[model samples]
Target: MKIFRILQIMSLIGVLIPMGCSDFLEKKSQDEVIVTTVSDFDEFLLGSGYVTYVQYANLYFLDDDIEYYESEYYDELSDVMASYGFQSWQPDMWESEEVIRTNWETYTSTYSRIMGVNAVLDGIDKARGEIEARDQVKAEALALRGYYYFMLVNTFGEPYNYNKKALGVPLKLSADIEENGMPRNTVEEVYMQIVEDLRESSALFEKYPKRRGNYRINLPTVNILLSRVYLHMERWDSVIVAANKAIQYSEGLTDYTKFSGSNFFMCSYDHSEVEWIYGVGVNIQFFGPSADLLSRYDKNDCRPGMWFDMGEYSTNRLLKKDYDWMSGSATPVNTVRISEAYLNRAEAYVQKGMTGEALADLNEVRCNRITGYTNIENVPANLLEEVRLERRLELCFDEQRWFDLRRYGMPSITHRYRYRKSDPWVIYTLREKDPLYTLPLPNEAIRNNVRLEQNASAYEPKRSGVEE
Candidate 1:
């Protein structure tokens, strides 16, 4: 009860900056704490700061999904947009303080969630509650913690296949805050922790009541996260197993043909296709779908109309209708959907040489998105490529494309930007396996914790034709 109350106060003050000094961690509020009962613990889990959505604005700039055009308001560009634009235009932009701070904020916010999770796990056992209620609370905390760590490692560390020995974000396991510096764990160690936590969470979910919405983690969500983890680890058979388990519970997909105009702005909160929802709102005024990305969509594919708006001059901007109009937040941006499970299974089947099974799964999702949908009879020579294309089409602008590119062998990315209507387009390229692909740790983080080493390939300033 005391720990939960402490966590409640800490959550309010945003004091859970991980590995901070003991004095900061020990500070407590005098306000009457409410986390004395099982229900109170549940409320703590649902607290605003603890269960917040992730913002994708920073990651969006790094991917090839968006394009930049000079606005009439400025022959030049605004500072905010200019900062992000340079990141897209110049490979060395990661060295900039602005870019480093943006990335650092995401890292700090994710670990803050982990801190809250550890608080619940540490106190749940002592609460006077029904056995089932305690287990359910603990399960949710484990899942949430694992989910945060998964995001951190993927963003800050090298892809699993690239090097298991590569450094990952610090792995924090306890509620008792440590003032001392913590070393980065290897990618393999971090991944193993994620798997262990999720696997335990799955077992605990059997004791918890079935949750109604995609907003909260449940049995199906656990399996879905597991499927994703397996996919990243390249455990083909496990991917199929986990995906199948998730599909058994939630298999609904929105029928695009039956739907009417502009469903693109619909968040997962209202969208039937979503299986789990967790993404923050983003402003895409200057960033729109790339010409190349728009080209990938078939004319008949309903997704283009539903997901993007081709305004005057055929400029493609993501539809904001699905987002919270009043608050400008988008629901389910960082979610796992039923379609993703099928995609996961399909990809796994392909890796396992079960081309027929893979194609069947692929067709399941394609039929729902394309008009006059028909199943493919013969597998294409590039079966994996075809599946990957569907993933890009299905999951674009949702913060998956950037990570997908990295995991898929760090493919070359080229972005074409035009400063003015009269200016010829200038192309910027990120070569395959470029050091910039793995962003450097924030300068402040390295300074605060001596144990935290800077990435080998820290950003170096390079002049590009685009004005900063």
Candidate 2:
């Protein structure tokens, strides 16, 4: 089936299946399908625009935050080894036959959703409903489309701040299927479109001013995403502006002082600080926290007690808050929280040389998370470094670490991998500013779109360092 047509069945499925009739004779022709109401478009938007399922778990392996250990039963799971390229920072991670088991969904899923949102945007203006209702639906579809593009440009293209002219994922704004093999857009072009979509979304939402549920995009979520995008573009003042706007809508930070141990793990879905809940939660079976990440938390910090736990294998430490190995479901995914607004502002302040303001924002988070934490009164010499550390600690596994590492000059990282617990360790190194910083277009994507060119691979000459 064509990717653009994925959402056409959304309305039919919603209308027919619920009536308990699966007969094809009851179905209407594609030309007869009418989604002409605000409610109809709203329902269509939910089924297509929202990424509630696990899509980008492979993103975790690219960062230094995770450590991989093969279990005694590792041989039983052929799929687990598909991420070897990602863990080693190979450019072919998405394209290589060795990594075939890894399902690269970000490219396909984002475009599918964009097509869905495009359909809504194309038709919502004509839908029969109150002006306010139609506007709100338009606002939501715009926000979702902007978000999908942001994720796409960031994942497949070079960091905007690094090289705005670099090749980005293909840009598709219309629901109407264009010719096959659409070419890539520049990073700057994609970012401009993202900003434009998000700003338009914000204006429409503000005009309507109806509160959307936490599960859906609202005014706060739009501003928060804007802040993140600005942060990536190195627009420090814009970051501060957007972050402050989002902070005003937030309830406040979640104090770690209130929670302890596995008695109750703190999940972001129900937390007060959360602005949006989307994305796949971490699974310990595939990856665990690196020693470097765990070391960043001070002994006085309460997060370790709330976040990490011993995995099913005694040797592994799993992110308890992400996924409880016991009876707890592994459903927690991407959470955009108020605390990130604070961190974003803090980083922006430091960049703009507002050290005191930066420390104030930084310490606000620390005071809440640490026991008996005294505010850092004076500006520390490494205030910028301090803010980065705090961000890694607060936002670890929330899908910010890898991007942060990229924007932080794509520092060299080393990973130790073993096929099994008893096997000798093999070291994989990603050199500073490696071409792999920008991920490859999925092999299938290139095969389908002949206009697409793959990014340069980091694995030049394919060197796998000496084993330990």
Candidate 3:
């Protein structure tokens, strides 16, 4: 977990800031771009644009070790799952002191990247060349801007579907900078702008052939992101359309056969069929977990099996046939799969008053779980509730359950257990949030940005070493 933190923190400054956030809106065209007049702003598209870089600064990287162990921290900084090898964090997990703070810091990079995009957006209005290519640049710049805003809004602001029109990061659309000490914009305004950016990004990126290579953005990734944003806003129609479009370009549904293959566990961003779009590579590793969480599963499960199993029903550690006492490096695969699209569609359908259609999508995902079960024809009328629960169980250990629970606006579930690895089992809460339900921005960020204010409830303990 400490290693993950080192990587995330390092990238915030080393990777994103130093690199100049160019990739955030870089163009791939080989043709030399030529600018003519302000009317030739499209020509600026030919000029070197900033590349888009997605820094996957993880939760474990954001907070100290203790927060990583607990799925929920009473105070956000106190407990987090990144310590146990989960890179993802929930927005509602506002209490993960660093989650909010580091994510806020992550903005330094994202917003910095946006400046590059905005520079192009501002500059291109005059220089011009291929009208279509120029148009594509315009679209990409807008989309890139939207993508960053989405990340910032999701992390710092409230969900679009919910309340409040007050305060979010400053809306810096152009690169020509002025005041660095801008407060936030209203959440309502941010969402509206975000909607415009994504819609435009989707349109622009779609003009080009899909981008491939380990970490580049392309048409499909934009679709996947738009779908996610729509989900947050509860725009069911847009979510369904975007997800389905993304799935069209998707490859395979599962790599169960190769799941534990060489370097599969920590290798970051593998080529799995279900991945519609992914950015920022990160390796995965297992570390701290309070023991009791392990007690629920069979002893053989790699994650749940690390500890002793009570085995009220069985004695031996039950290993999944696929794991095969796996050893050595295992690559990490972190992308929303086609399975996720099905899940998203299920929710959209449920909202659209199409329970039967929703159930079909839900079952499609359930039927494929490594721990498979029959998809029931009689899915409950409360399909949303069932979807929420399935998301928790199905997505557990995927760095997702924590966020899923928080996004659904439910108090997350918890349990207690001891550290059984080197000693006996102990008790601890697996999940919980405190104060305003969000962790304070990290102390470092609070001190860095004058415009940035600390959430009163947020504060993490001083750490002696890297988070273990």
Q: What overall lDDT goes with each candidate model?
A: 0.70, 0.74, 0.48
TM, every model = 0.86, 0.89, 0.62
Lowest lDDT block of 10, candidate 3:
1-10
Candidate 1 residue spans exceeding 4 A from truth:
1-34, 48-54, 70-86, 89-104, 263-265, 268-271, 313-316, 320-334, 417-426, 459-468
lDDT of 1 by residue, 1-468 (tens): 464455443554255433233222333455334355676566667552245554445676678877774443344443343454444534344445655444425655566677777777777778778889888788888888888888778777888888879998888886665567678998899999999999899888865555647467777778878888898999999999988877877747777777765545445545665666655544445557778888998778888776665656432255533433345544444555678888888999999999999999889888888898889999999999999999888877665777788899998887666645566666667778876667666565666567886675565455254332
- After superposing candidate 2 on the true structure, give the runs of residues whose Cα lies further than 4 Å from its correct spot: 1-27, 30-32, 70-73, 96-102, 208-214, 263-270, 284-286, 311-332, 458-460
Better of 1 and 2 by TM-score: 2
Could you give candidate 2's per-residue lDDT for residues 1-468 as a string of tens digits?
A: 112243253342222223233221122455334566778778767666677565767777889888875444555344456667777766566665545444444677567677778878888888878999888889889889888888888888998889999988888887775555688999999999988998898888778544634467787788888888899999999999889878877778888787766564555545667777765555546467777888889889988767766456543355544544455554545677788899999999999999999999999999989999999888999999999999999888776788888889999998887656567788898889988878777766777678887777533555475696
Q: What is the lDDT of residue 264 in candidate 2?
A: 48
Per-residue lDDT tens digits for candidate 3, residues 1-468, read: 000121132233333322243332232233222234433333222222233322444432322121122222133222133222122222233334443443424556666566656656765545435666566667756766777787666555544454446355678776443435556787678877887887777776676665543433456656766776677778899889988887776663553433443233321235444343333223222223324333333232232332222234322222211122235322223344455666777788888888998898777665544343556878686788877655543334433443344356625333322222333333222234422233334444444557876654344332112212
Could you tally the backbone clashes for each prediction? 3, 0, 54
Candidate 3 local Cα displacement, residue 71, angstroms: 18
The 10-residue segment with the lowest total lDDT in model 2: 16-25
Backbone steric clashes in candidate 3, count? 54
